[model samples]
Target chain A: MRQRISAVVIGASWGGLDAYSRVLGKLPANLPVPVLVVQHQHPSGGDKLPWILDTRTAMHVVAPMEKEPIEAGCVYVAPPGYHMLVDVDHTVCYSLAAPVNYSRPSIDELFFSAGHVYGPGLLGVILTGANDDGAAGITYIKQRGGITMAQSPVTAEARTMPEAAIATGCIDQIHDLDDIGTVISELVFGLGA
Target chain B: MKMPESVTDEQVSIEDIEIRLLLEAIYQLYGYDFRCYSKASLRRRVLHRLGMSGMPSIMAMTERVLRDQQFFVTLLNDLTVNVTEMFRDPEFYRAFREEVIPVLKTFPFIKIWHAGCATGEEIYSMAIMLEEEGLYDRAMLYATDIDKNVLAAAKKGIYSYAAVKQYSENYRRAGGKTSLADYYTAKYDGVIMDQRLKRNIVFADHDLATDQVFGEMNVIVCRNVLIYFDRDLQQRVFRLFRDSLDMGGYLCLGTKESLRFSACEEHFEPVVADMRIFRKRQLMKRETR
Candidate 1:
């Protein structure tokens, strides 16, 4: 069976905004899969991430809503104070849970769920975070034959998270945030096409 | 002290017992203590792992995680964070060269602890700096982090070509002797860093949160990593760094992060105040009086 990448799960922390802005902003509107983001931010306060991100990029962004089905060409964020998970039917689900890796809207939770539903059909990207939160989930995606990428530690504002993923021996590539869009485009165009 | 047979017993529900049991099971089975990670991050990481394992619930995931050692390793990767870049803060590199590298020339051998060295970028940056300063041959660099996965990547030294542009700029700002482009080869437009930079570099798994100091270091560069930690954790890490450094050693932190409010502030004197670099001080004879 031919594997198709239908979804992308990305995690970021610290200097993630610049990378996210570059990658997410450049995403073509006709993309075949939905891009889900988990950017670590304050629990009680967020400065209109969707708007800020929207201004920088072309991708239409919105925080995922409860029970909403995943959609292509749209970006879904794990809103503050929630762990966004994809349901069995590919619907987005949210919960008011305590922070993970000391963060709400954790990238691990989002990637893990996507890996479960999509298995090898998912692509997990771990970018600029301060702690070791996404390594395990990225490995899980790879275990199910999903593609995984980590930000080049040199380019990350905070290298701990990407370093953690790389340490797992599961990452396929390490790219700077600026070039991540090209990788995503390649994946979207389908590998080995 | 045995209870009577007629005593009523209350059974704990599996769901209620599951979260706690899973956390405990991970600790007992794998020995990567995650019991202290913030609740939200832990819950999020475990739940995601459960989905990836195809286990119906945390309990099922726990059973598999405990029984399968490999699975536990996978769980650890998910639970930990792995986001990083090399020369992340370009100014810091510039500061290191201007203020720190000059002082390092006096030492016969240099031991640098790049605490939280994710994917080895900073270590490589340091290697480049040391090489540029004619010190690479005499330096032993220790790149340590709790993330085993990233440590492995740091060892590989491969990167995407897209990053080279920013890295090139950062390199120039940090005072590069040669082209940053010279560091890696172009393969399918992807970048593979020079293997020479990794020489004498040891990438290992060490947690600053709970683990004791592994070796004495001449300088410790634990940058922006401290911002994520609470005050107590920061204090603990500062103490660890203090203990790990030799007298007259150097301590470097992230641009926004500082040791002024830390419990161990008195132990270090500012070397480059604005850059957040500090030097371990030898107490004056008058202080003893």
Candidate 2:
């Protein structure tokens, strides 16, 4: 079934840069949806993730300036030291609110907010992570009728997050790292070319 | 199979009810407003407090929060997380000192508000910057926080000596004109801020979530505080700051916070966009027709 995915939310931590490079690498230059990502890193090193990802991906990658628009075909990384949420108004909102699950830019905050706002139009991907941060978020996505995907635990560098997400019984698919991006493209643009 | 119509889904949970009632109880009993905080963060904190308090659930926790004065203070501390640092983002200070201070030089006097200034690190930083720039004598800083405990510490102008090492690094990076050691003296485990820094500062209790804007000012430095608020409250605070700041006054937000979706965005122009510093537009007064 080809349900339109208006936005994609990706959550990763611990081994995220490699996971992001792999996934974002496969995305086409003109994919027609906004992609928001949360990759937990040190409180001071936000510039590195987007800088690194921009080289590996076709899409425009940025750690957006405050109040920057959320545009399609652009990849937005959650800046360090803040929790980022996709507003119901379709703009990205950042918060310095206390950490959730000991993470400033917690995967749950991004996924849950995007899930609530985008609802069935959202697709959430939980990537390699050390902690169980994205579990409740994927559940929220499911409750909102959004599609959820997890990198197959067997293929993940840190399988805890994927396994936890799968435990929620909300993931629509558990995919190999190589196939996850392809699955997203097929879901968003469909298989027929 | 269809779901039961009588059963309400995730939109309304038992915890949600408990949280609502808890917030209401706190407001009615203690007059501290948590009603407009970002919901998820509030819930997380309340649940954390619940776990720490060894209460069975939020309902039980709410009862204790309302009745126990000491416990309420703990809950208040949990709600307002003042994880702040001196020269937290050194770039912000550098931008303000380089760009904004030049414009302020045109004025005879300057009034600055350190809104939600957790432990006054920002207040001290600003004081030092202004003093070095030859502007502190003409500047008055109003430092405020919702949590009185933090405000008390801020008033003392002392921080752990261990932490001063990082602060020194931050001071230099923030374009400090003189050595940071000139401003503070070490006393055993903690360092006492120079008394001159407090000469022009007024520390007060101002709750952005509930209180009214006090005095008009030339510049307002409210950094990471807005991140704790939901959109509605954020807008309310923006409007308050807009009203509090004189036309052409400066407003510096958290580096990560933006005015893109703010209701008051039009009233200000970006001074340093990437640093989240904005200037209120100098609107022309209209002649009556």
Candidate 3:
């Protein structure tokens, strides 16, 4: 019995640009599920991440406006200095609330919100990062009956994040950095499809 | 028997139902309408409070909120995110000076409303800019927030010295013509803003969710406040702002927010698109809401 995945949320911090490029580049443009990415950055950082990701991936990449509806086939990048959450109404909303774990766009904020909204239909992925932000969020997704994945710490540019997630003992699968995108595509699209 | 797809799809979790009841209880007991707020952020805040208070669940918290006025106030503070800084986004101020100031100069007397002006840092920033531009004497700034405590603090016009040091850098980057030190005096780890800056300002408790429009204004600055609200509540606030603005008046929102999806979108034209500064259209006749 295969569950239909509704959304994919990916989180990365240090060495995120290269990790995102390599992973997102593998997913086809016509992917059915919307991919939301939270990459740790400074509050005053440039808004060029979406454009850079767009150049690498086939899917449309955007830093969504407040309350923008979540659409399939587009990759949403969390804007700096704001916590991005998935509303129950299937729209993306931003909050100016105080930072969690010393990060505004905290991976836990996104994952917890998406997990609550999507429930069993959610897919949470933790990638290379220097912090333990996504560990708690992975636990949340697993408790919500959603699937969780982590890039193997050995292959990650920064092992702390994925290692932390794995330590939560919630992740469903562990894949190498090179195979993460392929695993995601398989889980979302199914092998036969 | 197989569960119907529609029934299963529409099912609400017990936790979600409890949160809804808590918000409803808050509205009924305190007259604070948070029912229309975005649930994701609200849930996080509520859960945080629950953890801190060591409540068994949201249901237990709801019961406490109903009976304990003090606990309710604490929950209200958590619900309303009041994290703000002076000249938080310098680029918005820079754009305001370049794009909106020229138009504001044409008006004889300026009326500016800073809705949801938490602790009044942004209001002071605006006052300083307007004073430098020679508009402060002619301007009456209304700084409002839902929290009366914050409003009282805003009236005092004092901030941490360390925070003010960072704001000075922002002030310079925001095209300040003179020294930021000229505006405030330092006193033992804290800086007191010039009392004159408060002369033309009025700090009041105005709830955007419930209160009616107070006056017609030349400019409305409500930044990062709308993100806390749901779509319907945001549309209601947008309509309120639209009706409150004079013809050709300016409306400034946070950088991440946009008027494109609101019902009043057609009534305003973008003055500084990147900065989210919009101008009310002159030709459109006002329609009663």
Best by DockQ: 3
User: Which sections of candidate 2 miss by over 4 Å?
Assistant: A1-7, A28-34, A46-48, A51-74, A86-93, A97-102, A111-123, A129-148, A153-172, A187-193, B1-8, B11-17, B51-56, B285-289
- The structural similarity of chain B in model 2 to the true chain B, as TM-score, is 0.92
lDDT by residue (tens digit), candidate 2, B88-123:
899899999999999999999999999999888889
What TM-score goes with each of the models? 0.54, 0.83, 0.95
> In candidate 3, how many Å is residue B211 off?
0.9
Q: Which has the better TM-score: candidate 1, or candidate 2?
A: 2
Chain A only: TM-score per candidate: 0.94, 0.96, 0.97
- In candidate 3, position B139 carries an lDDT of 96
- In model 3, the runs with Cα more than 4 Å from the true position are A191-193, B1-12, B283-289
Lowest lDDT sum, 10 consecutive residues, model 1 chain B, at B3-12
Ranking by TM-score: 3, 2, 1
| lDDT winner, 1 or 2 | 2
> Global lDDT of each model?
0.76, 0.85, 0.89
The better candidate by TM-score, 2 or 3, is 3
Between candidates 2 and 3, name the one with more favorable DockQ. 3
| lDDT by residue (tens digit), candidate 3, A48-167 | 889899999999998899888898899999988999999888888888877887898999999988988988898999999999998988888887778899999998899999999988
